[model samples]
Target: MSLSDDGGYGGDGHRGPETGQTRTRLPGGDGDLYGSGRRPRAGMSSRNLVTIVGVIVLLLAAIAFANRDGSGNSESGGDSPKDTGPGAARPTAPTGTKPVTGKNGQIASGFAKTEQGAQSAAANYAVALVSANILKPGERHAIVQQVFAPAKVDDMQSRLDAAYSTAFLKKLGLDAKGDAAPGMTYVSRTVPVGTKLVKLQGDTADLEVWCTGLFGTAGAKSTTPVTSDWFTMRLQLKWAGGDWKVDGFSQQDGPAPVNGDDKTSGADQIAKAVEQYGGFTYAR
Candidate 1:
């Protein structure tokens, strides 16, 4: 199943056991020849046939009555089973809060101080951190400064800079400025599938954001062809500057699904699609 299709209705059907008949000997008079190992009377078979038909009908009715899911039982003025009712569950309900308004370059900022805000911050931060824009020196510094807590900024910047060094960019077919060669498109985008508020305390929150993304370069001549990956980013957030900020973060490979059977697109088609689509500012 795709990430987009979580918690859907299955309408699983339950099958009742097959119906059958059991023969039993009833109290009989001396004329009961069948059980006596004698030839049965001619007219007696007719009465036995009638009895079998009645038993089959009654058994079917009992089976049908036992298998009801009880949805319509209340309408008949009967008490439904306590475990079964029309009550619903909203396990994944929306927070009813809107997306953050403020922006720091392409990254969202000024998130609310609530749990929803922390989750929203984590999700948007995932997008910004995994984005193609982060490869560029200017954008990388700006993102680190605006999205991370004050104490984390310097460390994160140094680490990211080293990770995306000149040699790394060259290997990935990008220039020193993190730009793709002409006729090629470097694609890096993270689409958040969902978010979880793992814990929340007075001034801190721990959250996880599940995401799937496109990464690498897309072009026929490009050595690094863009591919998709799944990963979950865990964010340690703290309330700061009247908003939630990332104190630190870590990522794990995935809860990935098996690859699907969709037809693969050409390099030109992938490049065109990336250009046509825009990124999102996510919320819980």
Candidate 2:
């Protein structure tokens, strides 16, 4: 990731002129996604230059705006969970011993055909999906099998492995699996900022999880220090295999707020804290 906002996907599998991972597609512009697009013009008139600059500025603004939590309907605002209908009991949690429930009385159901339960199933599954544990091989595999749709399990697992490969880790100064380096703390945490039900019909709810996560290392000489980001993870949950399982999901960058001026911690302290603190079972 680059440090500035000029970044773009150069079509060479490398991040260009920007800092973030995902690149933006200009509105109404044709893309060679398969490698075809307009060739760059070397020079242009003042009017055209100004227009181009305006477009770039607008593009960035659009990206930022689209990503803003402007709706103000976020659960973090303390809105009460709504009931879908009368006499419907709250969704159940996975039973280690008892069932779990979500914001409303609705069952946290998944696809009846998938491996997990529904909404609650999807929420819980997402927790594990973005956890620090996935840095480990065995743990990552287990998480994939448990959270993903059975039909896509193998493909997802392989893709994830490739995405989190050694080169990727090195780029972040992390070890092969996502571990923080010695004397430094590597942070890759996904906090559930809120959960919203976009649509809920029998056995399926298109749930959107608003999340904020910190990714980077804490320490002197650290190039990629910890920084926070906001993204919405949309999950297509289905009831399958006796519980709610995720059939598909996708991530889009921020409706994020401006960066806050919080005090930074020492590298060692951050590392220790990560080791000491455990994650929570996020509820709305």
Pick by lDDT: which candidate is best? 1
State the weakest 10-residue window (summed lDDT) of model 2. Answer: 8-17
Q: Which stretches of candidate 2 lie over 4 Å from their true place?
A: 1-118
Cα error, residue 172 of model 2, in Å, equals: 2.2
Each candidate's number of clashing pairs is 0, 38
Q: Assess candidate 2 and give its TM-score to the true structure.
A: 0.59
Candidate 2: C-alpha RMSD to true structure equals 14.4
Cα lDDT of model 2 by residue, 156-228, tens digit: 6665565456765564466776676776765556666666566555765566665666545555445443444
Root-mean-square deviation of Cα positions for candidate 1 versus the true structure, in angstroms? 26.3
Compared with the true structure, the alpha-carbon lDDT of candidate 2 equals 0.46
Which of the numbered candidates is closest to the native, going by highest TM-score?
Answer: 1
Question: lDDT tens digits, residues 216-275, model 1?
Answer: 456655433444666666667788888888765555556667655344456677789999
lDDT of 1 at 161: 70
Whole-model lDDT values for every prediction: 0.56, 0.46
In the predicted model 1, the residue pairs found to clash are none
